[model samples]
Target: MEEMECGIEKKAAAMAAAEEVGRKEEAAAGDVGLKELSRKLNDFAKARDWEQYHSPRNLLLAMIAEVGELSELFMWKGEVRKGLADWDEAEKEHLGEELADVLLYLVRLSDICGVDLGDAATRKIVKNAAKYPAPSKEGA
Candidate 1:
């Protein structure tokens, strides 16, 4: 069944990517929430007749495979950390590109399932704010 349509702007996506994460309370750029990204994903899959193949089970596998490809960037089993931490200037850049491959699949998958990662993260933060109640040095 076709899900409810959400208007996610590309400009919003760019803005969110550009915005600083540690800044003060903001409107949350990248208005293109999970639902929006999913819609885009749907289009991509449909064009290639791939949606029929994207069962919940298979989607999980695809995600895993892409993740493994990403992991190849740092599978030295040596002193290196999980990512490009050990590499010099040139290799680190190569690792960065590999990381993008992993993220692209994740984004596509999230888009297919209507997962607005940013919105979801924000909502979770709000929930945590109420539950955790951070220790304030001085009462406001």
Candidate 2:
């Protein structure tokens, strides 16, 4: 879990730095081009001395850990976390950082496996909408 959380932070720092340099001209290359993204992921890991720590097994475990951390924000508290009620500025910032952590590991995992997350997510949303379309409020 710690490993995964660390990886996410690491990736985000690199991405933010890249943005500062005007490297990413656009949001990911859309549906067809992820080659460069994967390469960047690989290079980022290598440069940080993290490649040795990121086997498929470790990466998978880390991804799950990151998810667990995200869940911890509300696993039992339910919607309290989402409500942002009673949360101080620090807590809000912490929450934002943790959520970003989950997203980072997710994107990294997809890159490692040569998967296109944006496309995959869009496809899943379409399938899910078909399977479970909006409930009819009129039925009430």
Candidate 3:
């Protein structure tokens, strides 16, 4: 029991340290963009030699799993408001973590697939705007 407690402590310490490093990096970069996140994830995988398991399919599946976890948080909540005004701090933090997981996996997958996610998203937004243009005041 003592050994398990020590192991858990060590794991917690390691995670905290990693978070500190991420915070420092984000501070240094001035703004945390997808490219920075992708680079950080790449370095993280390389450090653990886990890149072998980060194939596109594996990343996609993992991302889907994270999405499922995120969905579970709102499963029976029945259309939460945009601000989540009723949620407590802990619940919001938990939601943030799950959302981060989904985003990190997606960024990593895009990196592996040689996709410029920001550029793609911008182009997609333009395409969507063209497809569904806002009604003019004259029409309304």
Candidate 1 lDDT tens digits, 26-54:
44424555555566677878999997887
Could you give the C-alpha RMSD of every candidate to the true structure, in order shown?
Answer: 13.6, 11.3, 5.9
Question: For this target, which candidate reaches the highest lDDT against the unseen true structure?
Answer: 3
For model 1, the superposed segments whose C-alpha errors exceed 4 Å read 1-40, 77-90, 131-133
Model 1 has a clash total of: 5
The 10-residue segment with the lowest total lDDT in model 3: 23-32
lDDT tens digits by residue: candidate 3, 1-140: 99999999999999999999988876786577898899889999999999999999999999999999999989999989998998899999999999999999999999999999999999999999999998889966
Candidate 2: tens digits of C-alpha lDDT, residues 2-103: 999999999999999988666444444344244555666678888998988876677889878888877776566645744687678887787787876676
By lDDT rank, best first, the candidates go 3, 2, 1
- Candidate 2 or 1, higher TM-score: 2
Off by over 4 Å in 2: 1-41, 75-82, 135-140
